[model samples]
Target: MGDILVDRQEMKKKVEKFKANGPSEPLDNIELKNPFPVMLKEDMMKMADAHKQQHHNFVQKLKSRSNERLEIPLKQNSKIDSNFDELANMSLDSDDFKKVSGCYHINIDAKLHEELCSKFYLKKSPPMSVTKYLERVNRLLCPSTASLLTAAYFLFNTVFNLKPSNMTCVVPLEAPPEDEGEIQMSPVNSRNIFRLILGCLRLSLKLIEDKNYKQRYYCKVVGMQNMPEMLRLELAEMFMLDSHLFINQYVLTRFIFQFKVFDHNVRLLFASMK
Candidate 1:
């Protein structure tokens, strides 16, 4: 029993020494199998060749189309000279100018000439009253509150540098009367005027805000406090209608100009009263 125990201790020591030293022989029998499949070199070359052939064909097609496009203009140019004689014989009359007063006048009849002149040369009717215009604009715009039209007008004028001459006080008729001698009234419609004013206001606001435009001059116009009480109330109402208008400094600046114009008119009215 003592000799058997001594043999077991010797065997344990040998196992410990083998573990400490690691394996002495090479692991030739442990074959390593790759988890991923390897692509053959010839197959890779074949794929590259196919891709190149497709690319070459695409390039050839592009060149052929480009050549055809270039040749089209050249083919069309040859036919242009042949049509010149036909074009020369055609008379080009001015749609706007009915009569050309030259050495020989156009052979149009006197009645026809008079009709053309009346149709083209008649002046448009004058714009409606301010109150009526505002009422119409409010109806069309459907503003959150009243007096937005008044605010829009002053803001538009200041921002866009509007002039009396440029202002379309009257709206043009959509269709002319069938009778040549009938009088046409071109009273300004609220819809047309409001659309124009709104468009200009939106465009100007966008430009001023986006480009960081200097608005100190316009700001002064809006900041005036000497406006009439009625006008001030209207402006306050406009602000209440859309708080978002105050978000942009440019829009806010324009908004203030409403008071300036009203203040000027009020001053004039008081002076006239005196």
Candidate 2:
């Protein structure tokens, strides 16, 4: 019995020795912790492919939506014909006219006839009259141009107290020639061309100051008509000199003049009154 007990003790010691030698080896199939590899390579590949596809799609969408614009021609299927009504209801002829006329015309630097002829293509034939030129201007140019011409007429009459008369716009048949040294720097005066639009604007402002000017056509008469006959002849002469410069300095520059020519103090005063 003592021998049997000694054998059993020896077997227990062997078992402890085996355990202390090293960790137990895993089975081929029943792995202890998936030692085959914890790699997520497939998942990583899928994520990479997804990113590439998204980038490609974004580039395609951008290319498809670039620079898509459309332009429509004027005088097409459009219909809005109330020009007269529009003019009647405009604020352009309101207070602005008064501001302009009060400034330049007070001095005789009123470039009226040149202002008219610039708008119309006139014949320089021997007997060119304001009435004849006006007839052509009325028939050829827009109402706005006509209005400007008429405004110039009144501007001349009121400031210098002139009347309209038939006169050749050209210098008389045998007038003395300008001196070689004396240069004539005339104001711009094309109807179609606007020189010193600011000057014109100044004229307009002065013409509209009367309350009853618009009601009984007084504005037309006092502002556009009623020019002294001598001034009318002078205007005719002015229009005859040049047309292109007249447009540039007058019509195109008209808006610019409003800001450039008027005094800052006057603008502030106007603003305060408003």
Candidate 3:
């Protein structure tokens, strides 16, 4: 009996030892051939660069498709006045540029404007530029309209992958003055409406082409308390929240901005028709 008890105690000890070091069942039949090693620094950098390139390419494709569907048509329409294209060009060197100087900060030049507009409708003769027109138009549009356009333009230019920019504590100019945390705009002249609208259009194409412009510029409008109610609402609708829907936000926003800016001016030119 003493021997049997001793043997039983030895057997219990062996079982406990086995339980302590028992192999866990393999996960989903994935037997480890070799354990995953820590990633090297070089390998990690390569992975990061690869991810950034892939992200840029994906955004380019998205912006391209949108541009094709929307801006391309207006560009092709023969009925639209060809002079507007020239006017776009003239704004660069002509005294007319001075008329809209209030809207354009000194940083943007006439040459840059020409470069921006020509991307959509590769025009010859005086070289029509969108950037120049935007500078002028923003000044011409109502103050409220200009404010909205400028804000929209900056937003369109800077965002990565249909994502809104990580805009921080520069309180939007539109915020209530009574609010303790609000930010205010400095005393400056220039219409934001045309800027925003044209900026959206320019950005849409730039994003598609993956050009240097989109890479360099990315500033949203700060304060926009005086934006026209109708224009503001329309622009907000155009800036899309979802990528899965029917139309591309970039293309749609550009079109809406252009129409809103030009439709009135064109109407005035032919106001007699009414």
Candidate 4:
């Protein structure tokens, strides 16, 4: 009995020793399968670039849609057009954040030309006139009605005081030369009215749009050789206009009426609305 007990103890001890040692191969030396695929640095960069492109495309789509909504506001909603109080009291976003098709397309016409000359101080007639340059601008930016109207407002305000009832826009003084070394700027005669109007339009586009176009591009469009001078004019306009740019639907509607735009309803709205 004693010998059998001692043999059993020795057998248990051997089993314990074997369990502690594990297998003959070390765990570090054993090869293990990977569950995930390994990606190289180049592959990772390409994936990142693809994501960036997708994001850029999404942003561009948003801007395009926004501009489309804002352009060509020549039409009216019969349901809303009659109610002056409602239109006036309506929220800022009532017309989709001031992007009214009412803010919609602006076309150059005889009526616009008459207003520019009689109201604003444009002396020259078409072909080489401010109106002709505006026609070119229409091709370039496709400015919304709101943008064009707001720009007109800006330019009109520049050379006229609001207090006067029958005031016409005055001709601006000659702008300083692009080269600071030059003694003085050239005369801003009747011929240079186009430049003033173009600057105003550029500023208006900047305010109404997605703020994507650069001043450098505006300089290119105006055939202004000096970028610095262009920027100076932008600032100068801002200063003259008292830095007020954002326009409301009410004011915009009034502007349309002031310009005698659209049909009898516009004339009616002008006559009726406060």
Candidate 5:
């Protein structure tokens, strides 16, 4: 019992001594050894350079591939003649005519305009429905009557280096209300209208050429199956409008000149029309 008391007293003394000393060093002052080896600054710089070089090489390879893919081959006379022959032989049936005349109820299914905008890299949002876009296009193209004024504007800009300002005046017309029967007028600019026309054209092309079954069906239902034919008809109509209005002397001339720069197939089609 005496020995136990002595040992307890000794333990107490040691505990009191430890209490007096507190910690050997402050927690923040204590040094810790890392398990992993520390990398040298030189080594880190070398690694960074290697990574940058790798990225540059990867970018170069992608650019090369892109260039190769976008390269167009020079066409021979035989191919051009064949394309012209095909265009000459082409004929629209009764059903095709009906489709072109807007007799068919064409519905835009599955938010196709969004998909097309994404594909074309167009940042603009599409109208609520494809029909609405079509209506806007028809209004712009025809105006009071079937006319080629818009076509002439684009052609003149592209071919004759004429600015859009020279072609059309920017009239502040009220936009159609989102809901039917709303007579609110929002001031729309001509440049925006031009962008809308371009967007509609690109959207129509995307719909007609989309590989997906549903999108293709929607395009077919809307009489957009023959995009080339539709464009040709519009151009022809524009020529008729030009004859009547005599708006610009170089309208058709610019179109013909610009048409010559197109691919042989497209050139052949237009040539056959002549």
Candidate 6:
């Protein structure tokens, strides 16, 4: 009973003090903490460079197709690609890449792009560089950016066959390409580059977008009189890929980076030839 009375008295005292002083409020203005560690501008710049190097190293390790080597299973709770081409090993992992229906980041390796440029140059005859051909193609097709990027992506994979095969043959095959259902693609070159681009661009547009140009539209746009040849090329490309033309953002970004490098190198090669 004495202890309870003492507690009541203390509470009464606090109340009285509050009434007298109109309630004491704590101040939050005082700066009592130590200064936070801060980097100099130069140090920050060096740190940024270090971060970039670390990122580069991480991407460098992603080269091989071995899931064990990468330690990142290509299909991490992802769907198996619909490609029927036995030779195609590329997987954008669009399902896993888009974890929980959200897209994520990806990086490309320098060596892969180097291979892209090397393969592009490897096939062509002298004087007919990739730049000249690409320019001719751009002028001829007047393709949209999405289709162009997709076509470039396809071209990269077709050349390397390192990713999902992007082999789009504009030329109709006379002989049976394979003994079984295996895909057989001819190399890209000056002779068929136009047809290849036409097929790839048209197919890419169809695959990537909702509304697409018709066969007659492509013929009119490309100034081609023969709709049959154009249709054949498109069908041939579709067959070559076994109708597996899906491209996700991850694949698209990687190829965009690679295509930039390819375009730059092609222009440089063209400049040097002059």
Point out where model 2 deviates above 4 Å: 1-142, 145-233, 236-245, 249-251, 254-264, 269-274
C-alpha positional error of residue 205 in candidate 3 after TM-score superposition, expressed in Å: 2.7
lDDT of 5 by residue, 9-84 (tens): 6657766765687768884574433211234446888998897677556545533543354221212321323322
Which candidate tops TM-score?
4
lDDT score for candidate 2 against the true structure: 0.34
Instruction: Give the TM-score (vs. native) of candidate 1.
Output: 0.21
Per-residue lDDT of model 2, residues 94-125, tens digit only: 55332322222121223553354344332332
Order of models, best lDDT first:
4, 6, 3, 5, 1, 2
Better-scoring candidate (TM-score), 4 or 6: 4
Clashing pairs in 1: 171-188, 222-256, 222-257
lDDT measured at residue 24 in model 2 versus the true structure, 0 to 100: 60
Candidate 6 per-residue C-alpha lDDT over 111-197 given as tens digits, one digit per residue, 9 for 90 to 100: 443333332222334455556756765775565566777876665444433333222211111211233233323456665565556
The most accurate candidate by lDDT is 4
lDDT of 4 by residue, 1-274 (tens): 3422446566566556656867578855744333112344468889988976775565455335434654433223322232322333456545532322232111123333333333322346335555566676787667777788888776654544221111111111122224322221123455556756866887888888775766677666666677877776677566544455656554444444444433576678889977
**What is the lDDT, from 0 to 100, of the residue 70 in candidate 5?**
24
Q: Ranking under TM-score, best-scoring first? A: 4, 6, 1, 3, 5, 2
Error of 6 at 17 (Å): 58
Q: Residue 17 CA error for candidate 5 (Å)?
A: 31
Candidate 1 — which residues are off by over 4 angstroms?
Answer: 1-122, 145-250
**Number of backbone collisions per candidate:** 3, 38, 16, 11, 0, 1
* Model 5 lDDT at residue 28: 54
Model 3 C-alpha lDDT versus the unseen true structure: 0.37
Please estimate how well model 6 matches the true structure, expressed as its whole-model Cα lDDT. Answer: 0.49
